[model samples]
Target: MNSDIRQLEPKQLWNKFADLNAVPRPSKKEERVIAFMKDFGESLNLETMVDEVGNVIIKKPATPGMEDRKTVVMQSHLDMVHQKNADTDFDFDTQGIEMYVDGDWVKAKGTTLGADNGLGVATIMAILESNDIEHPAIEALFTIDEETGMTGAQGLKGGLLEGEILLNLDTEEDDEIGVGCAGGIDVTATRTYNEEDATEIKIGYTIAVKGLQGGHSGMQIHEGLGNANKIMNRLLFDGFENFGLRISEIDGGSLRNAIPRESFATIAVDAVHKEAFELEIKLLADSIKKEYKTMEPDMEVIVTSVDAPAKVMDLGVQEGLTRAIYAACNGVYRMSADIPDLVETSNNIARVIVKDGNIKIGCLTRSSVESSKMDLANMLRATFELTGCEVEFSGSYPGWTPNMDSAILKVMRALYVDLNNEEPHVAACHAGLECGILGTNYPEMDMISFGPNIKGAHSPDERAQISSAQKYWKFVLEILKQIPTK
Candidate 1:
């Protein structure tokens, strides 16, 4: 464990965070973190339960005078999405996260900070250790595989928690309370064709889109971060109509939930037009950069050469793949008409790859309304089918539907007004949260999510505002203390 981070506020919480940061607890590889949590709970003399998939449930009795208050489940996920900058040398499964304090924020060096849900975990730990705060029975639920799939929540059996009220610690913003979130479905499309020889007598160049500020697809999708794959596809389709360019290899995007920051395509073109091709690529990049100046100022596009000449995709396959990706949904399609400034329906063209004898494309669709989500997914499936590609959809998790008149929402709003002299902003998030799935598992439960201000989650630019942590901590403590006993 790094000794320096132990100096941060809430010493024990930061100490454990730094220790877990050194354990390489990326999604699906959380055994060490799980063990650490289990050991911590055992040391606290709390009843602990861990499922086969690494989801840990630690039950703690209330503070001395609040034993009769209603039990509240403080929940957060255990796993985190591992993302690093293109230049970072760290390995997700082996190396520890290198974190540092930047002014009033905490961030990782050239990688994601893992604060999306880590703050929630650490706060629960701090609450568990605190004898001063008063609250009812607390079931600290730590779920697994939240970044990729809601596998832990989906596979959850009933009767895990005794609490009917759940507080989700996954929201990114500090001042806003997340009452609802979009449900999401993963749609994959694939096409296979026989390889063909490079018949076009053409020069080869790699067209690349880079430097865009890619962020969490759900959280920052509205921020207008450029999608490299989509931009590259647009450039190729629009520019190459007058030239003969066939893509030999195409690659872009990393995580299913992050806006792609960079993408590259190797193309075969006529030797005579090499100079013109480079000029066009430059122009295209400049055009996109100008278009998204406010959101992605660093966006860049480039052309280069590689040695692999024999392996090339068929022109038919290339055209079909390009059309499928370009035609599919790329950004927020519809804003919520019901809620002002809320994104009601959106789609992320997640990833594209040529693997295992097939060219596959993954798209994630999200919406707060269940039927709206289905409509978007169906639209993408229809679009892919038009390209003669086979498509499949995963079983989607439900959205956490909002109840503006919720009892807990009322209490939280009142508490914020009492503490901050102003009402907290109540809104729904575009990102997927486990509250939806968990709510389904326990239908009668009331759920809401809130967290410290974490910017650029699931991306290399991730940072947490240190000032927000103290406010959130104080607010949480006050809420627990104000709970009424039966």
Candidate 2:
């Protein structure tokens, strides 16, 4: 299947993408990919260097007649979000993505397709290795761990590159040219609780929430897609209220940047009310399914008898935990008052874990405005703190401020109109891009972002549009040919 992808139109781009996806490159653990990129750069005999934080840079001198143009920084992150279905057996750390062509898209088997930034990385790779494509002097900046953190971009120092213009290939919509993006922070709530011995009269059942179309938390937050952690919390909350249900263990979600797709819990309820509990819960599950039928057609909530655990969570903490999760905001908190249809702020209840004597809830909050970002972060902090959890905010990065007057923006806008007789959607997005962090040091650089059409990013349903990739590749070549003169 990967070979098929390499054979697609614009073979150079798709082939590089296939090569990149073959490497196991999870966020915060990119040692293998780093070395792979280093070898690639060295093979071309270009001026290559790795930054202190492991960002890979490969410099390519401009071809004939383009040397006088401003040096362009072609940037994309090397890391990808790692997520899989509960039933999938593949190991992300050891196994390369198994991808296939489905109709007009390229999809992975029960895991993330890595198209979010992988396609971007591959685009840079193709351009760097090209012998005939005319372009200005190029500095290929492959930052690491953009998914887990922007540490790679944050650690990048000033004056490392001579480029005056930066082209970020990390946007999702092919018709949209991203001029700005939201910043994000990791808001986590953690605490420990006492574990009580399971009562003799309690009977155990497994509560599983599965089959939700999980996606990139930031990009898809406005789509009203279901979050598995939130759904599990809803069931547990109702169960406790009606049947004295207690939790023995819960492990839900995978990453902070990807919306949770499935959750499984071990719970016990009083045997005396077991019949009523099952009946009522089934009714509730039906309601949940009906509510999400349009958005989550395959969503399922199942309950089945299971061997009981020796211990369960303390009742007091369980109550507070469920309440806090229910009250905490998840989804579009506010839309940009200025940008039409642009999500200004949002949150995803990305992860939740409860077992033995501990509980942890992880969330990713994003906003284009810094004050609003912290406002929502503080709101979550207060909600969790009231329930006896210690809340902390970490990995905070600033948003990219849009420059409608950018020189490259003018050129790209005109190019789009000329090529397709249609104007591109030039706007900002809710998803975090490395442009803002990179701009922190390279404050004077002109930056713009555009990419191929990718759907269901950060989840197993993630796929890249085959036709859109062909369109995007042509656009990339045109943009390179039209680089502004120095």
Candidate 3:
């Protein structure tokens, strides 16, 4: 953590944020961070409890004369998406995040800043530790494993929280209040293939697609950015048909929630067609560069000569894999009928790998409507099944339906207008939020999500605006003061 961050406005919040940066809190590996939260809550003398699923909840009594106000549940995830640059030497499971101030933003060096939910958690910490701030009874909920899966939210039991109103501090834009979010599911397909001995008459080469500006699969899916896996598949399909290319290995993207930035494959080419293959690859690279010149200016494709492999995948399997990837859904499929510019359905062709005598593909699909989500899932199932691959879905979660008559929405909107003299934008997000899953457990809770301006979440370029953090803190304090009496 940088010393300058400690000097930022709203000293309490910034101080807690700086402390959070000193702990490693990647998804599904949040033992240390959870322990930190437990200690912090105990030190403050608050009523704290850890649920069976590892969710930390701290109850703070209302200030004197404000005991009649409704209990407010402030929620944020404890874990963060761990993404680092290909060249960075860092271990998210053991090393703390290195944070610094850049111009008007706070960012981590060559890694995700964890501002998506860390800032939210810090804000809750500041509220819990403050002695001068007046507010209603508060229940601060810090969930775990939100980035990879909503495990904490899914396992939380009803009656665990006594709050009637919930404020989810996980939205990205400072000026927008998120009332609803899309649901999502993971789809995986696999197929087995026989390996054959590489013939002596063939030469080996490694083809790679890299330098794409990959980002959050759901939030940045409509940006028109290139998918490295899709691009490599196109190149391989052409080579298989034109140059009799036989593939021995395939690997790409790591996470299912992030758009693929790079992909690599090793292939064998007939000695007689090696020269033609090289020329064809150069032409293809030039054409692709032109296609994504604006959206992915750094996109690159390279083919390098390598020693021949001992074994290669069957010719039929190679062709089938390429064809299946080419046909899979990879982007926004529909727009919301009620909300203009909102994405209603989308799919991310997240990952691909060939190992253990099988080729596996991973995908993530999201939609605000359940029917539309199932529709897209069936479409992807049909495409992969046609290629003789088995398809399965997992980790499915529901969407939060927007309530036009929400009490918190009415309170926050009026509060924003009074504070800034301008109406704040109230909208639904295309990305997944834990609110949807939590809503199922606490059906009567009135919920809304809002946070300081954060950009490039789930990617190495993630950052948060410093000024927005201070302003958000002030806004939250004011909302607490204005909560209605029960």
Candidate 4:
């Protein structure tokens, strides 16, 4: 735990957050964090249980005179998106996150801060451990695999939780309440390729696209930020058509939820056209720079000499893969007709890799409307299938429709108005939240999601504002105190 963080306001919350940072809790791999939560619950003499899918449920009895209020389920995921800068050397499976106080915010060095849901998890831990704070019956629900897949929320059974009101703490903005969220599906396309000896190539070079500000695919997709995979493919397709380039390997992106920041490809160019190819690449880079000058001023395109590979992808496969990727849909597809500024449907071309004998492409499609989500997924499937690649879709989750008359929403809004002297912004998010799945399991539960200010989630530049953390903690405590009697 960092000493500086322990000195922050809401001391208990910051202390618990520091403790969480001392343990590795990457998405889909949260055994240590789960154990930590269990031990913490036991230490408080509270009832604790782990569900079949690893979701942790800790129950705490209400304080004297508060038992009459409805049970409030404070929810957050245990796992976080693990992302690091290309130059950083850290292991997500074993190493604890190294974080430091950066002026008014807390940030990790060359790596993600994990504050997206960690702060929420730590807040619940602090509440469970504190005896001075007043609150009604509490259920701290810590879900797993929220970043890569919402397995914990998906597998959670109905009737297991008795809470009538759910307070989801995974939202990023401090001033907004997330009343609903978009559902999502994962799509993958794969095609086996034949390799042939590299005979026509005289010079080999590695082309790289880097230094772009990759963020959460859903939250930041509408920002018009550069997609590394798309940018690299543009160069590859142009080179293949005009420079007679032969690709040996292609790799880009790391996670499906994150916009790709870097892409690399190894290719060969005939010695006769080397100068022309270099000139063409330079021109292409210049053009791309101009296109994204304001959004991605730091974006870089570099080419350097490399050893020639013994094998290269077949000409047909190379052209087909390049063309399909270039033609694939990415970013926002539709905007909400009801809610201003809300995304109704979107797609993220998240990852691409070429290895062994095949090339694979991965995409995530999201929408508030189920039919629209499927329509976009089918569109992506058709685009890849037309290129002779096999496509599969999985991990589909339902969207949460907003309830304007939600009881908890009214309580939280009144509480926030009293605390901040102003009404909070209420809206639905484009990003996938566990609230959608949890709502399905407990249809009667009144749900609302809000949290401290967290920026750059799913990226190395992630940070959490300290002042907002303090304010959020106070706001939540006030909300707990005002929960209506059941």
Candidate 5:
């Protein structure tokens, strides 16, 4: 139970995490969490204010003898990516996350653990509400909508902060210090298709692709894990090519940042081809399962018979749509030549929906290079446009350029070495972070990111390492004390 979660060592941190999880704070719908943070700052009698974009800022004076240190902006996002299992009955907008302790990790019941940025937020909150911890003049920045569009970071006006340095406590790996991150853009394709009447000779069937381990699109895109949308499209493409399958509706994936884990579709086929359709689909399912048996051992492709739909998509449009999806890029597009083993450009076919006479496909394309990013985006656009989709690009953001010569980077590297007796891996990650956007407004603030171990982010399997949190807490305290003097 969360009661046990609040009792975790360093009660200051876990207790705050428990408090924050009690409020529903889905991305783009952060009113309650924003208010909760505002009330929290006010309760402590700190200087609190809400920005025009719904970000909450709380300022706390320095501790005794620490007034000479440069001010620090401790930052984390307020909203979380809301994802749940297909069988988990939960409402992200109305209910708090149901959390529990499992060995050395805390997780939610068949839902996302929200540890991506929630842990960072809780860390800042703990320090803000504490009187015993030593620190410089603290500015706690809680930005909203970070999981979706990062509008809070983008809309933040300049000259609002007095901090000379920034500590972004949002990175996942404990053994790495983040110096840069990839930028991203949202690509959406939509078009209307003519509906054809389902003849009496047609029979209906449902196809479901589930049990895949979906994760963060940018961070885990290179893992070769199963993508439900791609997998579902493969089956549909094959079924139509062989047995003349007609799709009535297709629904796959949830958010553009998360790899698709589950997809379901309603399709129709001629009565004469029913047996062939089932046999071919199941055979292909077995083959596909064998292909991913190592990475996705629990992957299942379920087929069931149902009542035929009243209408189905035109054959020409269906053919084009399926082919375009099959041809589009879904995983790591390019690996960096400068950074070994790092994905430089990638795309996530995050969402696919087909209903009535409308079809929409959503993708999130990310890259460290602006030219490479647009190159892949245009490639996807041309592919979809050939199939008659009107594509629009939005939410474009720049990547954080690496600064190995940074003053804070030097301090944190030395600090990590002293604490763990080992050098931390200093590298740029593929995930999207708000630091790059915030830097545009505060150009001189030296930024760095580090955090505890979080695995399977942007998925239901998300969990935080307990021992790593304790180690990070120790590191946070030392970093605060070592903040460079003015």
Candidate 6:
């Protein structure tokens, strides 16, 4: 909170970030942060509007020399992904993200750094307050609940902004300018399995798989990181098949976009075979650890005693569900053959739960090509249906088709070349962006996304590079200065 700390460039942005950190702005709970931004805009005497869905738009006048330049929307999401290390005692709804300077990067104590769009929000605030920079008319567009889903951007009504161009500040890399992105949908499959009371099958123990480094399903899917849910399911399903164990309850994964980090299962086994089952689970864990040594060295599987009577799943239902789930699609399904560095199709086995006489599993499928996305979703849905489970699907959003000859991209490319010695990487992304939705709202507008270097987004290791803040600021200014007046 010191003024001197607030004066450093990225630290200045970090100061605003600190303000954000102090508030409880997790997805669907950003009223406090929205109010703060509204107050900040009012204090600056800038025109501000808070839309029906908590989207905020703060307008600032163009600088002296560029008063006639086209209006531009500097966009970012207001909410942050609430993730924490398994051992961290902090509550995301109350405590501030305890950030620290790690070399040139800024990271949280044991949780997500919220730099995905926090950096975007801070940079916009800094640009608004800078008295030395010259630029075009600006509309700071902050949307809510981007982490949970695209609800905020999807909820944005038409005719909310006067901007002719939109600049999305949510990309991760420092050198890449993302012009297009994949569209995705959340698919859930539920199987209602009857659980009957059974005689006290000698109580064994529950197995828990945790401490895995889960990351953004879209951004880090290609990294071959271990998914705790998948691994736990494999261990349980295979172990049960071989050890004759029965499951009492099974649950795994969290956010639809995050690769699951922790999973737990309570099983009922014959008391005599308990020792052998525990050893088998341990051996399975060791085998997987050795298999994915470079990717998931910190993986752990532990079995602990639970005091409970046997209420295991019916044999038929358990076998059907296990087979359906294990056979379900997960991780990166295909890498882009044409784009060299792009993930063309992918899916995340996002969430699984067993409760209230039913079992539900959710998977998110994404692709730059619409057909491929639907194909994968259908494949998974058919697999579930084949096993007698009910399936539900959501209407998918359209992908942003990349235009190599796009006018805004040309302007941005030229600006980057002018500011930096090298040209920016112009390409598409595997993750979703607001451009596809915004384009539908403003058919005449030109849009592109770029951002400072951010790493480990949607995970506890998330961080933003301190040095890239200045470079981002400089490039944004250059782009604004070069935009021709209508």
Pick by lDDT: 1 or 2, better one:
2
Give the number of the best model, judged by lDDT: 5
The superposed Cα distance between candidate 4 and the true structure at residue 272, in angstroms, equals 0.8
What C-alpha root-mean-square deviation, in Å, does candidate 6 show against the real structure? 1.9
Clashing pairs in 1: 202-269, 202-270, 203-269
TM-score of each: 0.96, 0.99, 0.97, 0.98, 0.99, 0.95
What would the per-residue lDDT of candidate 6 be over residues 1-486, giving only the tens digit for each residue? 223335557555767877766777899899899998999888889999899988999999998988878898899998988888778898988777777776777788889988888888987887777787788999999998877777788888889888888889989887999988888888888878888664575675778888788888887888898887788788878767887777778888888888898888887777777778778878888888898889888888888888754577887878887888889878887777767789988999988887646888888888888889988999999988988889998746767877777777898888788788798899899888878877887877778899999888888988888788778877877887877786
Model 3 vs. true fold: TM: 0.97
lDDT of 3 at 306: 97
* Alpha-carbon RMSD, each predicted model: 1.7, 0.8, 1.3, 1.0, 0.7, 1.9
> How well does candidate 3 score on lDDT at residue 213?
78
Comparison by TM-score, 2 against 6, better one: 2
lDDT (Cα, tens digit) per residue for candidate 3, span 1-486: 578888888889888988998899988889999999999999999999999999999999999989999999999999988888888999998888888889889999998888979999999999999999999999999999988878999999999899999999999999999999999999899989999999999999999898887888887888998898999998998999899888899898878898888899998998999889999999998999899999899988989999988789987887888898999989999999999889999999989998557989999999999999999999999999988899999999999999979999999999999888999999999889999999998999999999999988888889999888877888999999999899
**Model 5 lDDT per residue over 1-486, tens place:** 899899998899999999999999999899999999999999999999999989999999999999999999999999999999989999999998889989999889999999989999999999999989999999999999998999999999998899999999999999999999999999999999999999999999999999999999988999999999999999999999998999999999999999999999999999999887889999999999999999999999999999999999999999999999999999999999999888999999999999999999999999999999999999999999999999999999999999989999999999999999999999999999998999999989999999999999999999988889999999999999999999
Please provide, for model 2 over 1-486, each residue's C-alpha lDDT reduced to its tens digit, 9 standing for 90 to 100: 789998898999989999999899999889999999999999999999999999999999999999899999999999999888877899989989999999999999999999989999999999989998999999999999999989999999998988999999999999999999999999999999999999899899999999999998999999999999999999999999988899999999889998899999999998899899999999999999999999999999999998777899988999999999999999999999999999999999998999869999999999999999999999999999999999999999999999999999999999999888999999999999999999989999999999999999998999999999999999999999999899
lDDT of 4: 0.92
- Candidate lDDT values, in order: 0.82, 0.94, 0.91, 0.92, 0.95, 0.83
Of 4 and 5, the candidate ranking higher by TM-score: 5
- Candidate 3: stretches off by over 4 Å: none
Weakest ten-residue segment in model 6 by summed lDDT: 1-10
Question: Model 3, 64: alpha-carbon shift in Å?
Answer: 2.1
lDDT of 1 by residue, 319-361 (tens): 7777878888888988999999999889988787763346888
